[model samples]
Structure formats: C-alpha cells, structure tokens
Target chain A: MSGKPVIVFDKVSLYVEGRRFLDRADLVVSEGESLVVAGAGGCGKSFVLRLILGLPGMGRASVRVEGDVVVDGHSILAEPLPALQRRRRNMGSVMSGGGLIENMDVRKNIALPLNYHYGNVMSTAEIEARCDAILGDMELEELALPGRRPVSLNRMERIYVALARALVNQPNILLIDEPTTGVSAAAGERLARFCFYYRPEFPSAPAAMEEMSGRPMTRIITTVELEPYLDFGHRFALLANGKIEEIGDREAVLGSADPNVRELLSRSRKVASPGVDDADSAELPPGGGSCWRRSDSHWCHQGDRVKEGEEGASGRTAQAR
Target chain B: MTALIGPIQGLGAQVCEAFTNAWSLLMFSVDSVAAVARFFSRQGFWAAFRVSLQQVHFTGLEALPFLSLLSLLIGFTVIVQSLPQLQGMGAHGLIGKILVISIVRELGPIVTAMIVITRSGTAMAAEMATNRISGQVEALEAMGIDVFHYLIAPRVIGSMVSLFCMVIYFDVIALVGGFLVASTQLTMPWILYSDYILESLQPLDLYISLSKSILFGFVITLFSCYHGLRAKRAPYEVPMVARSGVIQAMFFVFVSSAVISAVFYWI
Candidate 1:
C-alpha cells in the first residue's frame, strides 16, 4: 500500500428489512491499490462498495462505517456534514446503472457536477473543453454527444459517459457499481481494464487542477466485483453477508478452503472473467444467451461462435495468449 | 484543494435561476394562485405579503398602461359603433348610458383578465417547469426552505392585487375614452354626452364589474399556481404545464365573467 489505509470499514454491520446485508464487515482500501471485491449477486458486493462510499449514512444509524475513512489524513466519519460533503468532492462515484440525467443533453449532464459544484467561475467554453478532453480518451469522440440526452445513448455509451464524468475530476478514489451486467463480457472486461490504462492527466487545463489542490494523481481505492468479473486487482476479497470472509492475493484467495468463499464462487451465477476474451463464444448466434455465454464462456458476437474480437465488438484482442 | 473552483460563479448561476423562476411564477395566474396557498401553508403571512407586493408591481402594475389603452379603445368603439344605431332609432341620447354599461359591466373585467392571462399566466408555467427539471425544488428542501412557502403563496397574492388594479385602470380609461370619442366624433354637446353616461349605467354596474374582476383574479391566479406547483417529471411536461395553466386560467376568467354578468342582468 502506497499510503496508510484510505478507507477502513471496521466491524460494520448492516441489515435491511431483516435481511443481513453486511455483517461486521472489516475492510481496508489503500491509496492507488486496486482491491477487487468478488461475490455473486445479492452477496453484499455492492453493499461493501456503498459502505466505503458512505451511501448508508444518508438514512440509517445502526449500519455504521466505523474506523477511519481517511483521505490524505482527513477522516470523513469525523468531519461535520458540510465538511464531509466538501471532502466528498475528492471522491468520484458512478453507480452501477450509470446515474446519468436522462433529460439533460450529454454535455450538460457531464457538466452538472462540475458546473453546479464548481459554481460559474469557469466559462462555458472552458467547461466544454474539459468535457471534450475526457470524451476523447474513450475513443468515443463520435459515439456520443457532449450535450445530448442520456436516453439517446446506447447502454455502453451511457456507461462510458458515466465513467467520463467520474474520472473527469481525477478524484482520490472511485466507487463504481456493476459495469459488466448489461454489456458484453469482452466489453465489460475492457471497461474495467481501461482504468489500469489511464495515467495522471497532467497536460490539460491547470485551472481545473487548481480546484483539486494537490499533486495530479489518479487513484483506485477499491472495486466491488464478483469472482467472475475480477479483472485487475492487487488483491481480491470475498464479501459474503456484509462481512469480508477472506482477503488475499489472487492465488491465496483461490487456494483457500473456506466453504463460504468456495460456495460463493461455485454456486454464484458465474459471469465471465472480464480479463479473458475467448473468441469461441463471442457471437450470440442470432438469438441465444446460450450456456457458454451464460457461464464464463466468452463469445465473439451476440452468438456467432467466431473469435470474440471480430474487430468491432469491443473485445478486439487475443485472450488465450 | 479542488473544491473551491467556481464558488462565486455557481452561486451567481443559482441566483439567476431563482429570479428567472420567480419571474415566470408571476406571469401565470394558476402559478400565482398555488403560490398563494403555498405561501400560507409554508411561509408566515408577513413574508408572503412582501413577496406579493413585489409580484403585484411586476405583473399588475406594469401592465396598467396597456390595459388602459385597450380599455380606452373599447370605450370609444362602443360609443362610436352604438352611436349610429342609437341615432338611427332616435335614441342618440342613450349613447352615454350604453358606454357606461359596456365599459363597467363587460369590457373592464374581461380586458383585465386577458392582460393578466397573457402576461402572468405563461410566466408561472415556465418557471415551475424549469424548477422541476433543474432540481431547484430539491435544493430548496435541502436548504430548509419550503418550496411552497418560498415560491407559490406570494405569486397568488401578487396576481390578485395586480389583476384588481388592472380592472380599475381599464374601467377608468374606457370611460374617459368613451366621453372623448362621444363628444368629439358624434359632435354631440358635452351636456348630452354627460347625460348619456349617467343614463347608461347604474351604480350597481360598478359593483358587478368589481366582483367579476375579483372572481377572475382569484381563478386565474389559482389555476396558474396549481399548474406550476404540479410540475411533472418529464421535460415535455414543462411546456404542457404552461399551456394548461393559461388555458385553464382563461377558462375560469370567462366563466366567472359570464356568471357576474348574469347576476348583474338579474338585478
């Protein structure tokens, strides 16, 4: 870990309507370390991420985010509401559904947090450039509107736009929800790996960076994903029933005989690994989410059975290398 | 370090949004009306009253000159058009009385409502629509400001006060116009015109017009405010709400005007 633990969830327990969501969960996400949380649906994967993101605090009291979620030595749980919100500006969040405003045009939607939170000091022209720069990174310069409606964009397009908004500020930590559920597995894995590819955006507008008040750095505090969706992580953690059952390097986690972790990975509705884009099962063959596609078998097209990277399906790379 | 980018600018934009929203709120009768109930329900009377005064000034007071001009034309046209008919029937002496009845009983109330509808009615609908889409309504709640008290009540009060003043203004202008046109265009002596005015209207005619204006004002403001407060979620809902506010406001104005006219006739 490059720095002391940025977010620590110590003995946190959460229950909703009598269903135990998170039970005495203890977790630590360090700065710049990618801690992938792997679990099946309803296995409290999202709950773990939300805990670190501080989502539960909006309503309940029993579900406590204990320990210290200290970012750069500032503990959020200790700060006042206003101060916490101010600190929240350093953290970027994109919910699984890509919480894009459907009514607003793309440019306006992305610009909202920046414009609204920043106020009006940056002129329209300057803000537009910031949006344009982020749009370029995803090679989505033509696929979307900087100022068009969210509903008009495709699912993946919406996801990228959501990502663009989240990363635009180059925040201290990013808390992302399900990014692989709706899109193709190849596309999904690439989306997660894309984070590994982006370096610090140093050469852009200094005016925007001035607002951030520190060295230009991009960090990934943690990622909540199931075993099937785990792509690139320094370590993987098993989140079962609100508590992290086991956390270790990939080999250790894979080798552990913990029934809780094995049952989670085995019985879990296994999704394809985002890192491996096998070509045999790419295509859907007209109308099928067939067994192969359903259970970790990567496909090229919707059902074509050809190479998964048929040059245009977003998984345009050899996986078995 | 990154949080303080556009502090001054963001606040400026919010203020801009607020004022524009307020301006639109005053433009429609329904919005103004809802703003009334919203005011009392949310804000104490004192705060609402001050906002109402501001609304009255912008919506009703500012509209006076135009209302006066329209009313004057109605008055002159009534005398001129009716003069030929009355003179042909050898009832030329009754021009004054006809002018008085038309101006006081019909033209005054209807014209005032029309002006208020065109100006204020549309404004409120647009404001409400914008607030719905922009999350300004939510911002209000977060800030401990009651959207109803802060936005709607004052509008209703303002619309009523403005509409009332407009009716009076329209009535006076029409009477003056009628007298000027009758004496000059008809070449009738001043004494004849004066006598005609006295003969055409009963004192009760003034009461009927005032009552009609009050009813129209209330209905117009109520409906406008209602539409504004009920802004829907969709973007398309905004224009729809605005159109509905004006249509509903005008409908009530006509209905009230007719009812008041009927009561005057029976009396």
Candidate 2:
C-alpha cells in the first residue's frame, strides 16, 4: 500500500438507540488502494461509508457520531457545507438499493452529476458523449434508453445504473455499498471488475493489473459476502462487534484466527468454490492457508499457497495459468 | 400544587417545541434564499431552470381552467346578490367600490391561494416527502447537488409566480362575470358598469391584492417543504407529512393574509 493516506477514520464511534454500531473504528485507506470491508448483514458496514461521507443518518434514524472521518485532508464532519460539497464532488458514492432519482430516466440520472458540475463548461454533446461512454463501459446501454426510470429497472439494473452514475464523473474515490447482493454469479464478476479493474476498451475481457495505467482509483466497498471481491482489494477488513477486528493483506486476512473472520472466510470460500460436496472444502484451507480458483475447470488445492514474489504490486494474487 | 406544576411543565414544553419549530422554519427560509442566490451564480442554471418551468406549468397554467370557472361563479354570485341591494338603497354609484373591496382586494387573492394550497401545495409536500423517504435527497447530496437550489428554489419561485398570475386572472375574470350578470339581469349599460368599476379601482387595492398573493405563495410553499422534509424515512410518513404541511400552510396563509390586510387598512 502507498504511504499517502487519502481517507482516515480516527476513532470514529457511532451510536444508534444506545447500541454501539461502531466503536472507535480507525482505518486508513491510501490513494489508488482497494479496501473491502465485510461483515454480517445489518452489521453497520454501510454506516462506515455514510460516516466517510459525513452523513448524519442512515435511512431514517440519525446516528450519533463521536469521531472524525477525514477525506482528502479535510475532516468531513467539520467541513462547511460548500467545502464538503466540493469534497464530495471529487468522490462518488453508490448507496444501498441504488439511490437513483425516481423522476428522472436512467440517462438523465447518469448525466446529473456531469450536468450539474460541468454543464457550463462542457457542451450538451460532450456531456452526452461522456454518459454514453460510461454506459457502454458498464454494459448499461439498454437501460440508458429514454423513459427507463428507476422504478422500471429491477434491483440489479438499478445498482448497475447507480454505479454508472457514480463513475460517470470519473471520481477519484468510489464508495460502493453491497454491489453484488441478489445478483447472479456472472453479474457479480462484472461488478467486481467495474469496481476494481475496469477497462473501457475491452468491457468483457478480464483487466490485467498491469493494464491499469496512471494513478489507480481508490475504492472502498462494503459487502455482506466477500467471495466476489476476493480477487480484488489490496486489503480485506472484517467488521465485527462495532469495530474493524482483522485487517491486513489477503494472506494475513486468510490466516487470521478470529472466529468471525473464520466464519466469513469459510462462507466466502463455500460460495466461491461451488460444486464441492466435501465438508472440508467448505472450511478455510487447513494450516492458516488460503485457496482460490480462477475458473471451474481448475481447482487449486488447500496447500497451493501463493509465493511472496508472485503477488502483484496492486496486491492481486497471481492468476492461475 | 404538583398537578398544577405538571400541567405548567407540559405547557412550557409545548411552547418550547413551537419556538423550536418556528426557528427551524425561519432558518430553512433563509437557507433557501441563500441557495437561490447561489444557484444563479453557479453551474447547472439551465437544468434548474427547466425544473422551475415544469413547476410553473403544473401550478399555474394547468390550474387556469378551474380557477377561471371558480372566479366566474364567485363574481356572478356577488354581483347578482349585491347589485339589487345597492340599487334599492340608492347606492348604484358605490357598485365599483364594493366590487373592488370584496372581490379584488379580498376574495380573489384568498380563493386563488386556497386553490394553490389544495393543488400545488399538497403535491409539492408529497413530492418532497417522497423524495426524502426514497433516498433521492441523500443521493443528490452525495452527488454534491444542493437540495435547496435544485428542488426547493424552483418550487418556491414557480408557486409565487403562479399565485401572482392566478390572482390577477381571477380578478379580471370575476369582474367580467360580474359585468355579464349586471348587464343581463339589471339591463345595466356596459359603459356605466365599466365606468363604476374603473372609478372605484385604486392602486392601494391592487397593491394589497398582489402583496397578499405573493406572501401567501411564500408561506404555503415554505411550510409545505418544511413539513415534507420532516419525514426522515418510512413511506407511511409521506402522507402524514403532506397532510401536516397542507394544514400548516393553509393556516399560515390565512393568518398572514389577515395580518397583512389588517396592517394595511387599520394600523
């Protein structure tokens, strides 16, 4: 991970109905790094993203926050409205259930940020071109048709449109909440690629780590399941008991002894490695090791550990040849 | 003594809550004004302008037919009933003054505001509440879009403009209806009726009518938005917020209209 910290959570604690949802959680995500925060459902994983955005409430109930979330060298909690808005402009967020504007069609919804921020400087044709490019990259051309409002789209389509809208501005930071929930396995892989190694030119081809040129986009994704994002993210953190309990490199996280982390790892492995009937296959690779399969045609066994030099600079493990 | 203390404490709490709400509403208005100013200086001018035009279309142009019908009925009823009485009392010359006082100065603005409150005001509240409940407001904020600039300001501007135009339309249509009734029933000359009405018309009457309409517009839209945003979540809260907004906006519209008229006429 790079030393430059782009987002820092300093002793951030949140309380809802006197229950501790976050207990002085501290995290630091650097520029061009991908961090996946996984937890059980309703475990306040989404709240962390909200806290980073300096939002006061979750859905309806207001959460009392007692710490600072600093983004791009500005404390979001203390920054004034205008400055905070400017800060948010540099970051893109996808809230749960894909918070697309109901009244606007999918195209308008995706074009909103661009139109609002760059409408004066950019022509309408330029804006439409940008929207069209992002829609194409996200494979959302069909949904971009006029009159396809949020209500008309299903859950997966809504999330995809929301992701497209967030990325249309080419935001430096992307905060996505549960992008793969209730989605098919193939769709989940596409979403993972979009969040991690997105390439506009080859939408279907797997994006190699070396192919991503320039400064990488910082991504902080929260999910109830971690299988989809296992191949991505520089670091994986498990949020349990209102605090980030275990966080480290993929191997370190895979070898953690925390019961909660073990359960999450086991669940993720079970989901990722389908058609395996052996109960031992569902459990974590024995001896604090990690196992991953790139395709169903080939299965890496428990002892097939990744060598130190084999890991990519972007923290991605070597692909199975 | 304890019973009295308990009741007094409850009263104190209620008063405090009322003051808190009033303070919040005042701050919201100030913020909305500031946002409107910022909206002009910032980007996205045309986008927000489009929303404002849509609001104007809904609140003003669409309500024209119903407003016209109601205005005519009111005008005919007033002239049909009051013209004979004035004639019997040898007060035919006072017809213009009476029409100006009752229809132009009072009923036109109030009835127009009532129609707005029923149609546009409730719809705005419900729409805002739905936006809030459905996470659209949060989405906008996340996108760095100001809710006041994009949503509230357009509605406020549209509602005010709509009320102003509707009041003027209501007055003119009602007067025409009055003239029709006077000419048909009493065989009054068109020249005589027009002369009486023109002679009685005053700048002060127009000022009061237009002022009340604008103020009513501000009060109704502000209250509706304020109450609508009060619903933080829950779909059920949308209707409740809309209902409360309508009641509060109607109450304030009446109170402000009365206060403005009393201040102008008496104090």
Judging by lDDT against the true structure, name the best candidate.
2
In angstroms, give how far residue A73 of model 2 lies from its true place.
1.2
Question: Which tens-of-lDDT digit does each residue in A145-241 have in candidate 1?
Answer: 5446776788777777777776665566666666655666557655654443342242444454466635333333233334433335566677665
lDDT of each residue in B15-131, candidate 2, tens digit only: 999999889889999988887777678776767877888988999999999999999999999988898898889887887888898899889999999999899888888988888
Each model's fraction of native contacts: 0.00, 0.67
* Model 1 spans with C-alpha error above 4 angstroms: A15-20, A57-78, A119-121, A196-202, A205-231, A263-321, B1-267
Candidate 1 chain B lDDT trough over 10 residues, lowest sum: B138-147
Q: How big is the positional error of residue A189 in model 1, measured in Å on the Cα after superposition?
A: 1.2
Chain A of candidate 1 gets a TM-score of: 0.72
Which 10-residue window of candidate 2 chain A scores lowest in summed lDDT?
A201-210
Give the DockQ (2 decimals) of all models: 0.04, 0.50
Candidate 2 chain B: worst 10 consecutive residues by lDDT?
B35-44
